[model samples]
Target: MTFVHAGHGATMLFMLLLLLGAGAVGAAVLSRRVIGLRILDYPTGRSAHARPVPKGGGLAILVVFVTGVPLAQMIWHHTPTLADKTLLAATAWLGLFSWRDDMHPMPALWKLGAQVLAALLVAWGSLGILPHDGTAWGMLLGRSLWLVVLCNVLNFMDGLDGLAAGCTLLACVVTAILCLHAGAGVDTWGTALVMAVAIAGFLPFNFPNARLFMGDVGSQCCGLVLGALGLHMANLPPLAHGWALMPLMLSGLLADVGVTLLRRTMLRRPLLQAHREHIYQMAHRGGMQPATITVLAWAATLCGAGAACALAGGVIGLPAAAGGVLALQLAWAVVVIRRVRHTPGLRW
Candidate 1:
């Protein structure tokens, strides 16, 4: 019992350190103003913010996360796993291109290509593209597709302040719980705990009227990390059916992006064109304040994630519990869309 308590304490302390370090680094990055310094200059046709803000705040997150994980391993006397190495390499590659994009506008095709390459690197390094029990071709294609879709979905959902960070925090907490309950190795739970802390530390500066944004650097890297973690969770021996949690965990963002794309396709809108069509944006354009809408979304995500974690932890059965939570999430999305649409002066 003492050993277990020690482990938990160590994990918590490590998380706190990472969070503080990441937040401080991000704040410092924002304070710089020099020629050739990368900054978000102004609102564009695709943006929601009206003023210029420092971008690449995710650089701080990546820096802290990258350094923190290895340090934790050293403190705990565990060797770095292959998955850890793969994550580091993938983050480095993605961060480079994302930083470039944040500094200067890059062609969409070029950025997309870099994302694809980075996803492939993760797949190759982590051996994470498919379920171990599945047939070779099917697993390869399915995993690759899942990685690509999730990576882009997270990137798209970064439209609002703190939304992606908040959502990822909820997901990581749930993942941590599930991992701990399943008796998975310390690395799994440790990684999730560390990520949750890092995001929490960064959230205050990002919520609503953000002082600095995660930009592409933060969002894409987060998406990659989550994708890797999800694959890792699904591969756990005790958690045979864990992949089922992905849909519920990501339901809100997936539904918004999926439905909006479908609606636009039906209306013959150009899919590549950017607009304030996301539900969060519409809610803000309506009478809802950004902070209020962000909180509401966070609340819904917490509930869904909690329910999923409960089910995964065996506190509830899978069939009824997962299904019910997913149903509620879909209903909530519908309600948000209807309210936003009905509000006067709301566009998209």
Candidate 2:
């Protein structure tokens, strides 16, 4: 599983293979450890799986990320900046806490506090990633809020097998393409490529029928990195409409998570408590196959991401692209809600 890019040459391909091999093999070994230790996510009323499955499989992603990234970045054109280093450090802190939570569930406040701290660390050292014109205070606070939102939204959407990873895989590829078009630093696009392939390594065991789950460990990491990278690109001078387009490109996730959160909030549902009220969860309970749900999510994500790239690249006007993508997502929401509305254990 090697992909040769135009200028980056064999380095990118080699690193991709390195990460893929590490992620796949490491995930397999972690699965055995989880099984032996009885670290399993058993089926609950809100769960997407039917049986107990290995839960800490995301340890493999963590290993591949920390080890492969340093070696891969050496091959990339740009060296790691202060912001990059800071982001990685923050991520390490996050993973430590998340891994603990994966083993023994933590309080919601603790998780939120840790996530906010990580987001703030990136904001503090993110001169390269933030806009140069803004006041430092505004840059730190505003971007921190945005990244925090992204982290939580992304985490909320990671409910089913291949759903979160597939959506993120498509979004990452699109983001990499856009960063390339805008001449973003290699640190940016390189991270995107590595993250995509790393997830590719983990997808096989988790998708279709779950043999292992990325659990809290992988979901939090995915959320944090995607949030950080997206905000970094949104600050690029040439990437007009990027801030708006980022959310829309992830409309499948934003719509489902956002709407569900809003719905739950209005109904005074225990926000901290987990439940199977997301449209995907409802649809799964309504008898939709996991594969079909995953495919639809990926399709909608790709469509939105493509439309966003067109808008960012000036291939299409903002009005046209936004209208098309929004309408498509709106229609998607309608269809999903209509199909799953009748399912038990799901309240709108």
Residues 53-129, model 1: lDDT tens digits: 76777776676567666766665566877677777788778877897888887988897788778777666656734
Q: What are the root-mean-square deviations of the candidates from the true structure over C-alphas? A: 3.9, 4.1
Model 2 misplaced regions, further than 4 Å: 1-37, 128-134, 341-347
User: lDDT of candidate 2 vs native?
Assistant: 0.76
The TM-score of candidate 2 is 0.88
Model 2 agreement with the true structure over 184-208: per-residue lDDT tens digits: 8767776776677667767877788
Name the lDDT value of residue 188 in candidate 2.
76
TM-score of every candidate: 0.85, 0.88
| CA shift of 184, model 2, Å | 2.1
Model 2 Cα shift for residue 31 (angstroms): 5.6
Q: Which candidate is the best by TM-score?
A: 2
